[model samples]
Target chain A: DVKVTQSSRYLVKRTGEKVFLECVQDMDHENMFWYRQDPGLGLRLIYFSYDVKMKEKGDIPEGYSVSREKKERFSLILESASTNQTSMYLCASSSVPSYNSPLHFGNGTRLTVT
Target chain B: QKEVEQDPGPLSVPEGAIVSLNCTYSNSAFQYFMWYRQYSRKGPELLMYTYSSGNKEDGRFTAQVDKSSKYISLFIRDSQPSDSATYLCASFTSGTYKYIFGTGTRLKVLA
Candidate 1:
């Protein structure tokens, strides 16, 4: 089975702290994505990487950034965390870029910014 | 207006009930529709995806799409308690890695 492993399951950080959420996929997928899930807003894309050193801003990328230094790993970074950024962060990898391709996802890391 | 819209339903149903989940999209450029299921405290997983305007079935689940009305539907026959989860609908166009998603519908199947 394809597994997307997130480095953290839960995190607690104070406002203005820089946060790093790491993800690693076992499969050799070319597409990796970061999304934040909030109640009533669904999952909003933060950023995505198509290959190493290549990243694109998504719909809600204002406060977040991503780094893909290797084929299997993608990392989401919060330059300066805020309370509004508290949410469940998910990492997903897809063999193809299309919605038709299945996106294998990590369990998620719930962030609590106080 | 939101590109995709769905009712945020905490729809409760008895086991063995047939469940219907729906979403609407306003983007005419969306070429594919997809459904993702998410359990509590877990990440969403892709359940169904359809590229054309028709019904596609897998096991007890059927995914239907109508481009004319820009409506998408996922039907579950004989729903089980294990099927309880939040269902999210998404749409995508060609040459892009992003998807327009609707707010999810939460379902609870009671035994």
Candidate 2:
């Protein structure tokens, strides 16, 4: 079974603090994604990386950035956390761009910014 | 209009009752439709996947797609308490890794 592991299950940070969410997948997938799930807004993509050192901005990338330093690991960074940035962050991995390949997701990291 | 639209329903049903979930999309380029189920404090898990249009069944779950209407449906027969969760509908354009997801419908199957 493929496993996507999130480093932290719960986190609390103060405003203006920097936050880091780590994700590691054992599936050896080439594509990794960071998404923020909000109530009534669904899962909005924050950023994605198709290869190491390569990243693309998604719809809601303003308050977030990502890094893929090595295969099997992806990281989401919040430069300055704010109250509005409080939400559940999810990490997912996929093999490639194909109809048959679906994303394998991590359990998620719930971040609360005060 | 949003690319994908789903009623953010907290639909409640008794155990053994039939449950229906639906989603509509405005993008005609979307050829692949998928349903994901997310439990409390957990990430969304892919449940059913359909390409183009038609019906597919797995156990007590049935997925239906209608390209002409740009609509999709998921039906759960004899719903159980364990079926309570948030159901998300997503659409993918061919050749793209990005997927647009719906707001999700929250279902509670009471015992």
Candidate 3:
């Protein structure tokens, strides 16, 4: 089974603190994505990486950035945590050979900002 | 206008009931349609994907897409409590890595 792993399943951070969410996929997928899911808003893409050292801003990329240093790992960075940023963060990965390839997602990390 | 729209229904039904979930899209170029189910506190899991503008069935689930109407539907037969979750509909176009997702409809299959 393809596995996508996030560093933390749950996280709590103080306002103004920097946060890092890590995602690693074992399927050797070329595409990785970060999304924040909010109640009634669905899944909003934050950022995505199609290859190492390449990143693209999604619909809601403000206050967030991404790093893809290796083929199997992608990281989402929050410059400064705020109460409004508390939400469920999801990581997903898919191969490039198929544009409609199914995404394998991590369990997700629910962050609470205080 | 939003590219994709779905009713976020907290639809309730008894076990064995047939459930239908639907989503409409404004993007006519979306050639790929997909359905995902997400349990509480868990990530969304891919359930069905269809590229053709017709119907595809797997097990007790059926995914139907009508490109002319720009609408998609998911049908669940003999629904069970285990099938209760938030169902999300997504659409994708060629050459784009992004898939637009709907707000998701929540279903409760009471046992």
Candidate 4:
């Protein structure tokens, strides 16, 4: 049923503030991602958008920055938030398969950059 | 090093046991292999989706891909407690669309 929605699920922000994480995918999928899941350092890939205004910079895009004007929305910008940018923040969407087609997540956003 | 090598396991099984999860890769141009199931803060739930190598079941999960021993496996039969959580192992590298995980393995299927 492909449904990825995330606007917030517990965020607190403080140090340097300015964090906006939002992702919406109703299956218009063209490829959209932004991940940051720490703990032995795992899901690192901080920006990806392959359409509407395209953008790319995975592998920990420092300080983070992304926004895909449209196409089911995908935004993740932290510009300043510190505290190591807190943790848990995922948003994925993929379609245009040819193999590696396994990414349809959302339901995360546990930022707490105090 | 660290193209994908998972062993963050908290591994602890009981209920019906028989759960083996692993991952190892140095990137032999990873064909495409996946296994995700995270449920502790949520955001990963696409268990098993293979390509290029071998097995792929979906009743109790079973995904094994061995590109000449690049190694990868995920088997969970009978295990319950909702099968605990965290078990990621992903790969994808050809023209690069990005899909490389594996730093997760925290299963605890007690009962």
Q: After aligning candidate 2 to the native by TM-score, how far in Å is the CA of B111 from where it should be? A: 0.9
Residues B1-111 of candidate 1 have per-residue lDDT tens digits of: 899999998999999999999999998988888899999999888889889699999999999999999999999999999999999988888677877789999999999
Tens-place lDDT digits, model 2, residues B10-60: 999999999999999999999888999999999998899889999999999
lDDT, candidate 1, A40-81, per-residue tens: 778889899988999999889998888898999999999999
> What would the per-residue lDDT of candidate 4 be over residues B12-51, giving only the tens digit for each residue?
9899988999898987888888888988888898877888
Lowest summed lDDT over 10 consecutive residues: which window, candidate 1 chain A?
A95-104
- What is the Cα-based lDDT of residue A63 in candidate 1? 83
Docking level for model 2:
medium
Query: Can you tell me which runs of candidate 2 are displaced by over 4 Å?
Result: none
Instruction: Write the number of the candidate with greater TM-score, choosing between 2 and 4.
Output: 2
Least accurate 10 contiguous residues by lDDT in model 1 chain B:
B91-100
Please identify which of the two predictions, 1 or 4, would achieve the higher DockQ against the true structure. 1
Docking class of 3: medium
Instruction: RMSD for all candidates, in order, please.
Output: 1.5, 1.1, 1.1, 13.9
Interface RMSD, model 2, angstroms: 1.2
User: Which pairs of residues have clashing backbones in candidate 2?
Assistant: none
lDDT by residue for model 4 (A66-101), tens? 889998999998988999888999899988657646
Candidate 1 vs candidate 2: the TM-score winner is: 2
